[model samples]
Structures are given as structure tokens and as C-alpha cells.
Target: MSSHPTSPRPVADLFAADGRLVAIPRRPARREALLAHLAETLFASGRVYREAEVNEALKTVHEDYPALRRYLVVGGFLARTKDGAAYHRQRTAPLPGGATPSVA
Candidate 1:
């Protein structure tokens, strides 16, 4: 899927500089890349992330605002909540008999 959502521009096509990819100083597909990127960062913690905090952390890598928002919401890398956002960190397992899976 393209990062633009409305268009066909893939995030990989967005570049850092000529002949080299910076992965920061971002453009259209910036958010699309965030989930996987942050996962690599927060892997050891196994914790949830609020949207704003996530953006702040990502800033060290990319410098765009709108693209970051879109990536978090549209990319399904994180889930938004009334309090803020949580990184998608857990796997769902089937419940026994008729029970529903645990929710946080």
C-alpha cells in the first residue's frame, strides 16, 4: 500500500538524499515506516506508547508532522485511544471454550 493513501506513492520511494536514504527528514510515506521502525526501538521494553511520545521519539529519525500522524493511525502500527495511543505489541490467542481474549 502507498503511504499517501489517496495516491500511489510508496514510502520506500521517499528519499533522504540523492543516492542515499536517510530514513529521516521525511516526506509522504513517513508514518508508514514508523511502526516497524519504533518496534525495533521498543522491542526490549514490551510496552505501549502514547501517540505524542511516539512522535517525539520518531523525531530523532524523521522530521515531518503530518506524515507521522498518518502513519500511526493509517498504518495500524499503533492503536489510538481516549488517553492517547498504544503501540501494537501483543499477539492474540484464541480463548478456551467461550471466553474472549484478554484486552488491555
Candidate 2:
């Protein structure tokens, strides 16, 4: 199966020059690409985060921390605890053609 979710936009288009999030794409593929980069770069795969920690890390990228956190979970780049207390990066599936998407 292809690693792309749906609408595979170029990964470089998702960010601004300042390393901040410019937009979260509407398409599933583009959104997943963004989330993957965020998850890989912002949070360590085996590390757990409290809600505040997650918010703080996300805030480093965008002002809308809560929305970004939610998108991370929803997009499967992050996984949260049953009580919503902690989060960690999920395993990243390899991309199609062996191309790993990045925000840059």
C-alpha cells in the first residue's frame, strides 16, 4: 500500500521560512505529511508527554497548540493515553518510493 494518505501535496509547501507552521493542509495526505514531520522532530518516539508538555512543544511551532496537538493525534503521528494525559509519537511508516516527507 502507498504511504500517502490521500492528497499528496509537496511536503515543502506546508511550512514558512521561519520554521513555523504556515497551514495545516485540508487534504489527508498533505496533513499526514505535516504531522509526521512534527511528530518526528518535536517529540521523540519513545518519550511520553504530559498535556502541558505537548502544548508547549506544539506552541514552539504554532500559536494554535491545542489544534496542532489534536491534529497530531488524529493524523496518527501521535498517540495519547486512554485518559488523555500523555502522548508519544507512533511508529512512522515508510513513505512511498522511500521518500521521507519533511517540512523543509
Candidate 3:
């Protein structure tokens, strides 16, 4: 049996009609893809965001901003300061096994 979701769907299908995410994927590959997309669309590179700013930006997509924030940080999609006061999108995030995605 495959570890992936029963049917692999496009990253876009995870969002609801109102544009908020319906659910966060449990599969590593899917979750990684979602995180990458969120980081790219919601954050600007080289721009530092306060914790409140991160929450607000995430809230635009889902009510559970904390969960999203945690996932982004844990997945290496967003890097935060030692104090967790600021965050910035990472250029290349590491995959589930600590492997960084290769740039084209």
C-alpha cells in the first residue's frame, strides 16, 4: 500500500471555494508542496515579518494560523529568528528527509 493519499490531487484543490485551505495534507510530499506554495504566495523574500505579521498573513488563508506557522517553520519553508520575533521565506526548503530541493 502506498503511503500517499488515496488520490493525489493538485495543490489548488486543497483550497475551498472562498480560497481558504480546506485541510492541510498529511502526506509529506503534499504538505511540502502546500507549504512551498504558501511561502511563495504569501511572503516576500528578504522581507522580515514580525510574529503578528506572520499570523495575519496566514490568517488570510486559514483560521488556524498557528498550525500553519508551525508547519512552515518545521518544514523549513520559513526561517525564524532565535527569538521567534521575525520570519522570512526560505529560498529553498529542505524536504522531509533533510534534502534540499534542487534549483533548475
Candidate 4:
């Protein structure tokens, strides 16, 4: 699980009055968005990601990348060791129906 809950938007001020959540914002990232980021990061981080390396790489994006890591593992976007000492991006399979998405 992620140590920090993800917010789609930045939380400017928690409480301008009494430290209560007022005018709450919603910026929830879609599962795919997170997966994409992970994919890119994994690609750039060399083949295998050590636990600390993965954490440091993703710390800025999310409080902790574990939640995203778990999501990716479950979603088939990434593969991990049972102990999670390493991580890798799964070769992207074509989207269902196999018709190739248009880039234009």
C-alpha cells in the first residue's frame, strides 16, 4: 500500500479556518495513468529496480509506489519478485480486439 494517498490535484490548504478538510479536491488518477508512469519509470530505471531505487524513483509521484506497484502486478503491466526486491515492466500486449490504436 502507498504510504501517501494520491490526490489528482494538489491540496493547497487543508483548513484555512479550523484544520478541517474543506473544499476538498478530487484529482484521482486513473489506473492506466499510473501504469503508464510506472512503465516509463521502469524503462528508464534500467531492467531491474531495487526496493530503495523504486521507492526513490516514485516517491515524488506518489507518497509510496507500492500501491501502484501492486496495481501493476495485478494488472499485468509489471512483474515482481515474491519478496519485491526487483521489478520489471511487462512487454505490452496489444489491446483487446487487436486492431492497433491510431496514433494520429
Q: Per-residue lDDT for 52 in model 4?
A: 74
The 10 consecutive residues of candidate 2 with the worst lDDT sum are 95-104
Candidate 3 similarity to native, TM-score? 0.80
What's the CA error at residue 96 for candidate 1, in Å? 12
Clashing pairs in 3: none
Q: Which candidate is the best by lDDT?
A: 3
Instruction: Give the clashing residue pairs of candidate 1, or none.
Output: 31-71
How many times do residue backbones clash in model 1? 1
Q: Using TM-score, give the best candidate's number.
A: 3
List candidate 2 segments past 4 Å from native: 1-9, 94-104
Indicate whether candidate 1 or candidate 3 has the larger TM-score.
3
Query: What is the per-residue lDDT of model 4 for residues 1-104, given as tens digits with 9 covering 90 to 100?
Result: 66776555333242245433343223344445546555765445226666677666655455546675566667766667777777766656665777532211
Please give the clash total of every predicted structure, in order. Answer: 1, 0, 0, 1
Clashes of 3: 0
On residues 41-64, what C-alpha lDDT tens digit does candidate 2 reach at each position? 889866778899999989888898
| Candidate lDDT values, in order | 0.50, 0.79, 0.87, 0.55
RMSD of candidate 2 to true structure, Å:
9.0
lDDT ranking from best candidate downward: 3, 2, 4, 1
